[model samples]
Target: MRQGLTWFNIASLLLGFLFLYLPIALLIIYSFNESRLVTVWAGFSTKWYAEMLQNQGLLNAGWVTLKVAFTSSCFATVLGTMAGLIMSRFGSFHGRTLFSGMIYAPLVMPEVITGLSLLLMFVAVALDRGFVTVTLAHITFSMCYVAVVVQSRLAGFDRSIEEAAMDLGCPPGRTFFQITLPIIAPAVVAGWLLSFTLSLDDLVIASFTTGPGATTLPMKIYSQVRLGVTPEINAVCTILVGLVATGVLTASLITRRQEMRREAEERQAIANS
Candidate 1:
């Protein structure tokens, strides 16, 4: 027999959700307000969104953010996968402790320190601070996140499948690509999305590394916030939230459908056997 939720449980859950999402809900609702002030809801209107469209600076910043997020996430995923594979499959090697420490240190390090260190490193290397520097910085930090995700997925992987592939005359490279990659593809994709979100949401690091004409969306938002809160910012934030929600929903649907199909195929194979 299934027990229904008690009043206490329901109340607690409702309170938790409200505490987490109330600010976001208010911001989204106010984005449609006709009044210039974000706190006072005059009436529902899309004027702020329209005005936001005409803002060239915001558009440029968004474009730069998208580019950097995509590039950095892609590079981070590849490098992180390699790092995870090395640590998981290779057992031990020279400098293993140092490599592992470097990979995980960013997780606990302060963003201010990370940003300042990267800035100093860039200056010492004489690398011009701009989109390239920002992208590199994002990849450097985001790769650690990806590595952690991939490593967790790899920890539970079955080695018997790989051995079977090799027994069937498959080379090491072929076994990895055909068997291991498919098994870990979900984790890799998850890592990429995490890296992308981190790159897009980062402010302090991007601010430190960004030069003129290379502002990201987070940096742009921060600059506007210093002036004051406006409905325009709320509208922009709402749009961004919607985009992220849509992307996540679409990815989840795709993954679910693929998993169902894979399950059906496996069931059919079992029946045939």
Candidate 2:
């Protein structure tokens, strides 16, 4: 019965994965199709790939998206790491629970609501609704993910090492830079990458906040998709899938390295004892 149940579970999971990914797999395959129709197969060719590169509007949107994602990710990483450190280390502070709640509240909230709220806030503040404002909104949303990831890493962290360094004449700032930061560097890096991907993939928030001539890659794709996806879109989708797969593999390697290092530390401590 247990064996049967295990097989059933595996089949179920495989089916679910196929259901989710088959369309994406089809998109990647169709990207090389010579046919203009996405669903039809007309011999493999890289013509669409060249077309994607030559489209001026898409090129501009891609550049804008890159700028927004990079800037938002950097800012989110800084602010999120700080928030994670504070939440993990200073939980006893007054209204700590409230602050943490507020920080995470945005993550679960509906995207439409979050975008609307940001739009209203920008309007009320009289901030020019442009690239900078869109970038800021992305940072605000992306930071929550970074904080969540880094906070999970920090939760498993042993604070005694940092405390010991402080007691041994290392200043708090120095200890953080030298000891605490190094230990969780993998998570921090992962968080930053996550923030970047999330920002790049965003559409609703960027749509609500972006002004004239500030279309992001996702926005460009979305607008065109309504008119039916082109061969160029298939090519773009293939590239994005490749990027996501690469990011996942890189993150997995980093996680594996961190685990190995942790096991080595455990063995070393046992030997010392």
RMSD of each: 3.3, 1.8
Point out the worst 10-residue segment of candidate 2 by lDDT.
Answer: 243-252
Position 38, candidate 2: lDDT: 85
Which tens-of-lDDT digit does each residue in 109-185 have in candidate 1?
A: 99999999999999999999999999999999999988987887688676888999999999999999999999888
Q: Which stretches of candidate 1 lie above 4 Å from their native place?
A: 1-13, 246-273
The local distance difference test score of each candidate is 0.88, 0.89
The residue-by-residue lDDT of candidate 2 on 1-273, one tens digit each, is 665578779899999999999999889899999999888899999999999999999999989988999999999999999999899888799999898998899899988999999999999999988899999999999999889878878887878898899899999999999999999999888888888888878899999999987899889998999999899999987887776676667766776777687778878888998
Q: How many backbone clashes are present in model 2?
A: 0
lDDT assessment of candidate 2: 0.89
